[model samples]
Target: MAKPFKNLRDKMSPQAQNASEEKAKKMLSEMPLQELRKARQLSQKNIAEVLSTEQANISRLEQRTDMYISTLRSYIEAMGGQLDIIARFPDGEVHISQFKEIESLQNSKSAQSSG
Candidate 1:
């Protein structure tokens, strides 16, 4: 009564398969923080431990519609990923490096102060 998914997929034309794959890639590229965490096989407790925070805080952060870029960057870094700010235009896209420069400056200052 049930058909195998592989068999169904195999029956599709090459164009349809390519389209389906592209759609899947697009969907994967755009997901909420919660979905991304789950896709990475990480739990709130795991992220909390990495961030030296509580699980409840991680939950609240994921639900927030607005958060600081630094907070978002730290969260992504805890998940073994980097965040980039990109501005898209009609002609092209630009990577905003101001945030990265600020981070570099802070790191250098901290290193100097510690030494």
Candidate 2:
């Protein structure tokens, strides 16, 4: 018998949840730079400043579906958020950190980096 769509997956087996998490991670991992920047509620200029990159460069990076690690980190930091790539075993639990801890991640990056 088919169950109604009441998010019955709440009781989903661990294997199912792992697959769901993996899919979510894959999608987020490949998110375009612009979308990520916007999700952080930041403008192109702001992101460029943090990355020490030019506006044109930021635009270019965002257009691509994949980016360098440093570039990804910069964008994540610019949005006052941290990007955590987690690998969970079938039985393992995921622990997400508080946003406050992520806010100051790039404090060491100089503000003058942008021109």
Candidate 3:
């Protein structure tokens, strides 16, 4: 026996969805790598080890304040996650499909090395 997933689109009120999406975007913009890594139960040393780099390199990445979207994508991928970007229109209406597309972009960016 298992519970089926709920339809998030049907469940979310327009106001709630707007606020939640805005919050997500703001958080992503300000998020530090250290917090994300810790939340994933990973350490800088662990990531450095995987990347074949020194632990100090991980420390610098964690302290980085500016996020290059491409870099963020790769880092997130290494943690078994992905980054996304979305836009809100003049009426504050966001397309639901954009979420999925953004995820694909993240995957592609991570896979690319010369971008």
**RMSD of each candidate relative to the true structure:** 1.9, 9.1, 11.0
Residues 29-100, model 1: lDDT tens digits: 999999999999999999999999999999999999999998999999999999999999999999999999
C-alpha lDDT of all candidate models, in order: 0.97, 0.70, 0.74
Candidate 1 C-alpha error for residue 86, in Å: 0.8
Clashing pairs in 3: none
Error of 1 at 41 (Å): 0.8
Candidate 2 local Cα displacement, residue 62, angstroms: 1.2
> Superposing every Cα of model 2 onto the true structure, what RMSD results?
9.1
**Cα lDDT of model 2 by residue, 1-115, tens digit:** 8887446767888898889889988988676657677756789888788878898887887777776655666677777876675557799966555433554554444444553
The residue ranges of model 2 lying beyond 4 angstroms of the native Cα positions read 1-32, 93-115
Top candidate on TM-score is 1
Per-residue error at 92 for model 3, in Å?
Answer: 3.9
What TM-score do all the candidates reach, one by one?
Answer: 0.88, 0.46, 0.50
lDDT, candidate 2, residue 95?
Answer: 58
TM-score quality measure for candidate 3: 0.50
Estimate the overall C-alpha local distance difference test score of candidate 2. Answer: 0.70
Best by lDDT: 1
Q: Where does model 1 exceed 4 Å of error?
A: 109-115
